[model samples]
Target chain A: MTSCSGTVLLSRITAGIPHSAAYDDLPYTRGGAVDRDAVGALVQSAADGDAAAWKALVDGLSPLVWSVVRAHRLSDADAHEVYQTAWFRFAQHLDRIREPHKAGSWLASTARHECLKVIKSTRRLTPTDDPQVLDGISEDRTPEESLIESEEAAAEAERIRRMWQEFEELGDRCRELLRVLMASPPPSYQEVSGALGIAVGSIGPLRQRCLRRLRARLVARGVR
Target chain B: MNDNVGNDSFDEAAQDDALEEALRRAAAILDPVPAELRHLAVEAYALHSLRDLDARLAELTFDSLVDALPVRGADVPRMLTFSTGDLTVDIEVTAEGLTGQVLPPQPARIEILGTAQPTATGTVTADEMGRFLCDLLLTGPFALRLRTDEEVVVTEWLRV
Candidate 1:
């Protein structure tokens, strides 16, 4: 089952590339830009049985889904299950998705629902009144020392690591908002609103306020 | 003063943009989505062909985990209900296996579908009374596909 040729092709297609080349190959790439319309095309094609298009969608949107799952502070195992379930559900609902352009929003909403389900089940089993206590317990970090060949890169990595420490110090709401906002290739304000259950109109102002607070924290720590 | 305020706000926005970008780069490098998970997601698309597109999806109407209040010290089995139109499938999941009933009291064939397994892990036949039991313990994400005399139905995926 694991030896499906499609799996091999997909890994090759997504391997080491930050974004899918298939995604970049879309006609919508004016100056190598990514927008909702391009995503809509991929969705439509995948719904029509295009495997490459499906790979593109997975490569492009998985990070957004991952961010939403992580924001709930679930264990890595639980988060993995949620992430897998969300994508599987999305694959099943590909043809029925009413708004292809808003697939990111669909994914975000699904992941959020899955996260809530996991939290509820775990809370029932463990009887924890505060879910926040589950926080910081799943800090699995991948070593990137091999990637830090240059002193300059090492210094930059350290700076960002410290910035992350400050980022963690922000309030839960701010941290969650920023975490979702940091999704690579970025997600739309509509997607962010769907993921975080915030008003779409409020995202800009809330993001500004949250970032201002984070920046202040970083400045105080002399990390910047 | 108004011009200065406008410039200050613009600069703040720029700074925020830069800071967000840096954090995004760091996250990509530090806390990436596991390669295995990404592979699974990509492989999920293959299920698109495996699933009968015409099959009616049994919507998950109730899940005990999300719905029921916890009773202290009670050994609560995970209860789930999926329904579409007049049909309902109620499943009770315990550590040992699954016990479910296809409502309206009809016989059917049930196939246990796991995400990792390309094919159905096992198939059980529901009796005339609409009750079926599977002794095989389920792990990870799973779903049920029911083939009855009238139509085919697939339940929503859930993790055990």
Candidate 2:
């Protein structure tokens, strides 16, 4: 869970990095397992306004949010708005998120809705010079193909869900730390340092420790 | 079927590792939010409390909050059951407080435990899409008494 313990250090370290990277990489997803129990712990903590919990929640679901936005074919500006909107909405519903396992899907749906709204609003405002823009808005996949693709996606999502059940045993800290470490381009040294509150130099060691811990936990649980 | 997977290739560790890689690929399909929007998510969540000030102001705040939620749908399950282990008991439920489509594995059965009076009994089947249909009769506390071909799996009592 993200606490104020790293706030000052995070502020200082993250100050140097350009914010552009946040948009550059895709969202991080835990491929092994999700450790929903740890997620539940963070959710309970976040309900009380724990900053680490907030960060954990964001790290956990950021990819889901991003995926939903992309599915809508929104531009970076529109996608950003939708992403922010999804997190904001997540806060309000945190207390009501009864099922931690479905959190990804929930976040994904919210991001999609926000992106659609943004696109609609943007279309109303921006003058479309390109005929392609108008065509894109009206284009739709064949219903049969859409159904097949939707089913395929749904099955794959279910498989991931099962994987998360195994991942839920690792503690919250490992989940959060490993998630950042696994993030594409490795969430920069400073970002990782600030997010996890480890000293910049200690991040490599901390990451190794976290991975070892997760491996042990997974092995103990008969996961992998 | 189990033998066909191959002893060397289908080891538990190998399956686990393969599943891990699969999850990574699955997550890749999901779109990511831009950095600026992430900052906004932080800001919006921080301001969630401020929405209580006034009704008119609350409306704007509520709109913003609604916008900030990470996912949205007209309707989705409030709870999702990833998997229920083998049934030594009667049956297992995977979700609560939902309408529209429900998904569960096929050939659902309840496992009966040691001489206990079987309170719940039913046939819940998954459709072609792996969705299920059954009325959630138990309100406050519920349990699954399932008897699969292999084992009887009973879920702990839950408050739905």
Top model by lDDT, which number?
1
Error of 1 at B11 (Å): 0.5
Q: What pairs collide in candidate 1?
A: none
TM-score of chain B of each: 0.90, 0.31
TM-score of each: 0.84, 0.35
**Could you give candidate 2's per-residue lDDT for residues B1-160 as a string of tens digits?**
2346667635644644444344343233221234455655555445334323221111111122233344344332334232332211112223442221222333434321111122434445434443445664433223344333334333432222
User: In model 1 chain A, which range of ten residues has the least summed lDDT?
Assistant: A25-34
| Tens digits of per-residue lDDT for model 1, B88-156 | 999999888899999988999999988787466889999999999999798778888999999999887
Return the DockQ of model 2: 0.10
lDDT of 1 by residue, A1-224 (tens): 32243344444434444542322322111122235776787777787777877887887788889889877767767888889999988887888899998999999988888888787767632221223322222243333443355677567667867777677668889988988888776678899988988999888888889999988888888888
Candidate 1 local Cα displacement, residue B41, angstroms: 0.6
Give the per-residue lDDT digits (tens) of candidate 2, residues A1-224: 34653343234323333332212233333222344455566666666667666676665556545544543445555555556556655665666677754555566555545555555434433221223322221233222223235666445444443334443344555544554444432334544453444577876655556555655655675644
Off by over 4 Å in 1: A1-33, A124-147, B1-5
Angstrom error at residue A4, model 2: 8.4
